[model samples]
Target: MNSSPSVKIVSKCFVKPKTILEESKKPYYLSPWDFAMLSVHYIQKGLLFQKPLHSTDTLLDKLRESLAIALVHFYPLAGRLSAQINENTKSYSVFVDCSNSPGAGFIYATSEAVNHDGRTMSLLTVQVTELVDGIFIGLSINHAMGDGTSFWNFFSAWSEIFQAQESNKTDELYLKNPPVLKRYIPQGYGPLFSLPYSHPDEFIRTYESPILKERIFCFSSETIRLLKAKINQVCGTTSISSFQSLTAVIWRCITRARRLPIERETSCRLAADNRGRMYPPLPRDYFGNCLSALRTAAKAGVLLENDLGWAALKVHQAVADHTSEKVTIMIDQWLKSPFIYHIDRLFEPMSVMMGSSPRFDKYGCEFGMGKALTLRSGYAHKFDGKVSAYPGREGGGSIDLEVCLVPQFMEALESDEEFMSLVYF
Candidate 1:
């Protein structure tokens, strides 16, 4: 790693947007945490090595050229959003900050051994606090734009552009016509409708709670596959995939640890990306959020009443239901409703959690040197969180997981033999 002095410059292009101010109704209501999340890159920093010598200006020019291509689809990076709410209306502004920084304020270095994986993963590290390095880059869109899958597709496109690769393959997957946002008047009048109880401020305050994360030791892919096969053998069902089996086992383990009454009920929130699943499959390159949540509930009685095989079957069915068109439509409706207006409030009281699978592998984020040795989100939010398994640096089928949970739960899980067996085995 090389060190360099910070550079600060002012450019008219970086100014804030008027839309943001109008929508927030407050000139300065932007959340620092949100802004930081939006701005952070997946690969915080990178090491690059080349033949002779290249001027810093040349590198900067190359970076700018690539960014312009990337910004064509990801317009959000080009500007910041502001909101304004008053008696007559709620408006937002999108201001562009034209100011320049002392350039990419950070040190630059290269090593002969540092391998360049091509342009897609060759982005240099973004300079942020060391603590924030491991977290995922969160973008807070209007929720009106699209879903998580759409966002992933966009990132893939941007990656292709950065690599100077053809985007035709990705373009074919997205909708030919861009999505149009539908406008609706809130049934209730006044600023009350605009003010979500769980405001952006609260989100920033409790974003890093310990209860939101938990650590599970890595497991070998072979072991996971074996476990899946064993589960299938016991259940006599070939339809269930390894991911479904693992999810079932995880759910059961968490339930046992919590020791809720056998009759009590609990739910796990699962996110599904609707890219390839859509009729005219969404563009694999469309950038924006295209994620939807599916809730799976288990009554303590139902779990305890059945053997592991039966429980796994139940979990499988629940997950299947989530992928149904009906479920997708329902989720779409909810996201666009008034209830979503207070989403921040709902997240706080809810025991919502996530279990991402397979998708982690696709984040193949490389910025010249090579794919990231590790990829993780910056901080644990209010909800309990976990990423799906990914290949470890060692090159075996080992699984790498990042989890956030309450401190107490974490302590218990760390020492619990049963939990360890499930996680490690």
Candidate 2:
């Protein structure tokens, strides 16, 4: 395992929106989907790029300027979170205060580290760390503000604005697919609800994360296609997708590595997006939290004894089962009895949870430093069983799996024959 790199903060300042809205004080109400994420950790992600020829002065100025302009369209990101409690109802409401706000935090730091720990309370925080041979731009976006789709949309838009600076098209540039500002609240559920919490932070608990070693494993496109085909043949079903096959492989490998009890309950939690699943489906570009965790479980003995096809079929079933009815039912239930998912909820025994997705345009964020050398995640919402998936930097439908687990489990996985055979590096 590599040693954890230390970081030193050079500068930190809040970057307000470059342009104010016509209705400055309008509050963006929290949707049922958005409110459900109040207690979760931030989505921490970063990009690695080789050193740009531009000087630090020029680079910093460009980043600050572009981010401010990006916030002009993503104005809600520039505001602060406002929470108010109703004593009689014993509930609270939280929303983005778009009044005179301090905006996102722009951080300048120097470090050998590329991943930033998502410890800030700010809605939108970015760290631009200057490395010895590259620049690491890490972002800590609040999950309440958006999901994976919205997060990448902000990145793509920001990058586009930055890339257009040389062509002098900044003034006329507009968001090709601007975010839909309307919040999603389930039918008959409400425009406002008294949450079951006294404060947002109270529900968003704080606890020390366990020591875990993380490694990146890459699988090629050809290998994935072959594996998917094999699984489908064995299962006698052509519906299993490449994603299901890959996820099944990893889940099985990790279960073996953990060396759990034979009768132990084992499960995989998949963050399934609701945009396409909703009836009259949401705009592909609709912003805000529209995702739910699809959890599927089995006995350890059953899982280990089953073939890869069986496991893949289970995954496929989970996706197929996540219909629009399920999404609405989920929201309806949350409104009835609201609850927060703490970090420990993700690190259960013999469990694996998937975060992010291979579908995101991870390598599309190019800010003149050429294409990203690779995509990396930060230290938030990460645990022994958490897995993040990204498209390979080389493209070609390849996939990269970022696996985090206990040190011993990691060592066992590295030695697993079937697991390592498909790993490209």
Candidate 3:
């Protein structure tokens, strides 16, 4: 780790805002699945710091304070989720812990580290191995919170504040009081957000014992681009984005590998940032959860029948409903739901769920060491599988992906030649 003087700087900024929403006072409810996801990230904590610094405490304190401030405006949801879960089920607390171990102490090592036993919430954690010279900051956040894009917004603001302090500049960035949810009319005639509680008698089955799990193969950027181009050619349209293409491919692979029936519709959830797409980019640096879920239908044969291009187009149209107004309305409705009703379960019948966003870049997380080697989701205990992709370096015209899936399904995909060709192209 390279030591730098900027690491010594620390700010005394603090905010104590009062909670306004009733949900703010409630505890977070973690269903049996939620608890499983949170447990997977328990041991994967730590961020690396390579910048030359005088003391680790100073840097950590500054980073924590910066994150806290960035998160202040979005306070109501901050402690609310955890509070709600604890009220109904057994509660667990997420704390920030730091250590300076050799080799594995850096964020680079910890960020990609996964718990084979699937007992932790986040697969990656900030290590901050060497603070005196080189600085590494490992960030590990639960997937339930906003996606990578949202995380980067909060991270960039932290970096900006840190840079200002290092140069002896006064802090000009301050969060406004009572963060408001930009209001908008929702699409469709149904409620903004609702969960189906009545399970069919046939849906009941004997409980299957939990099994140990591991994240499958690491995807490269080159193959992702090929898949996108191929999808475009087949679909005969360019309106679809690379994200849509890759998601379709993954959804297809998972369904086929799992032997899911074609007629059986799978519900896949994609994460969307209701920012610039909204009336105005909701405070570029506004922290807290500024995300909404866009649900898409996952038909098993969709990818096999069409090329990558066609899949991409289909995905784009399927998810078009997730607009800024739709997201705001969804959040409002979720907050208003009864404590006994677990809202996330509404998508359970869909068989699978997927989420992705471009927020990872905004982290501005360069601590002088270098850009983070990898970024991925914390863990998915509820859904059957989850995939998160970020833009790659060098404008590779491809996106880097981090995927979480059932171990058996991942193994079968890895051994299949066709899937490998599409993934690595």
Candidate 4:
């Protein structure tokens, strides 16, 4: 590893939105979809780029100014959550206070060579660090505010505006797909529906988070193509998708690496997008947490015993079964049950969850930087079995799987020849 210089923070400031929210939208209501994520932690992600020719001051100013303008469309980022307990139900209700208060956090830090909370803070925080040879932008957004799609869409649009200003073409800059802020509230549900948790703290799921380690395994176009092809060929069917095939390979390898008991159940969960699965269907860019966590499981021994194609086929079935009808049913059920997604409710021992997606425009946010070098993540939803996917920086059919696991399991996975041989990097 190269020895890098440390970064020192030169400045910190709050960049409010260029515009304000209308009074009608003041207590911006939170939909069932958004409320479900109240127990989740903030989403932490970073984008890295090679240092640009512009001075740090210029770069920081443009980013901040562009961010302020972008917040006009994503004004929720400028607000904080206002929660209240429902007297009768003994549950808490939360909504975004879209008032002009603490906006997004902006930090400017530059390394000599070089080189970073949650609740009651700004809903969004952005930190741009100038490295010895690059820049790293760190983001922490409340989970209830949005999901990965919303997260990247706002970032992409912000960068789009920045690039326009950098080239002095701000007049022509426009967001092709502006964020759709309308929450997806189920029918008959009032804006004041309270969650099952009496207090906001009741929604939080706590556990002894073990020391964890992570590795980003790269899968090239050819490798993924061959893997998909080979798996289907083995299964004697062509229904397996690139995603299913790749996820299967990972699930199987991780199970083997963990050395879990044969009888134990190992689960594979995928965050399925609900935009296409909604009743009337939502926009491709509809903001907020419009996603469902789909899971499938098998005994560790059974998963290891099966061929890669067998594992892929199992995952494909789960994906195929989540139709619009089922999605509607699940939402309706939530209305009756009204449970929040606490950690215990979603994660478990020996389970792997596929999050983010290869479809995200990971490199589309130029911001006048030549090219993004790589993406990094902060410690947020970093459970041992969490796996976040992103399109490869090179952007072919390539993909990057950011795998987080307990330290010991990560060590075993790195040395597992079967897994390493299949990955491009």
lDDT for each of the candidates?
A: 0.41, 0.81, 0.44, 0.80
Q: For residues 1-425, write the lDDT of model 3, one tens digit per residue.
A: 12244543232222222223444343323221122222122222123344543566676655555444444443322332211124233432222111111101113233322222122323223334443445545444443333345445545554665565555552555522233423222334222222222321212122221342435343456676566667777777666676777777776666666766666666556666665556545665433344555666656665455554555565687667666666556545544451221224444543445545443552345543355544433333324465555555434454655555567876776766666765532
Writing each residue's lDDT as its tens digit, candidate 4 over 51-140 gives 888797888888888998888888888877777777578877777777646777776531111000233677887878776898887677
TM-score of each predicted structure versus truth: 0.61, 0.94, 0.59, 0.93
170-288: candidate 2 lDDT, tens digit per residue? 89988788878788876776677567766555566664558999899999998888999999999998999888899999999999998889989999978888999989799988888
Off by over 4 Å in 3: 1-58, 61-150, 170-212, 216-223, 276-286, 298-307, 323-344, 380-383, 393-397, 422-425
Q: Which order, best to worst by lDDT?
A: 2, 4, 3, 1
Shift in Å, residue 286, candidate 2 = 1.1
Estimate the Cα RMSD of every predicted model relative to the unseen true structure.
10.1, 3.2, 10.1, 4.1
* TM value for model 1: 0.61
TM-score of 2: 0.94
Worst window of 10 by summed lDDT in candidate 1: 111-120
Superior candidate under TM-score, 1 versus 4 = 4
- Give lDDT: candidate 3, residue 56: 62
Candidate number achieving the greatest TM-score relative to the actual structure:
2
* Cand. 4 Cα-lDDT: 0.80
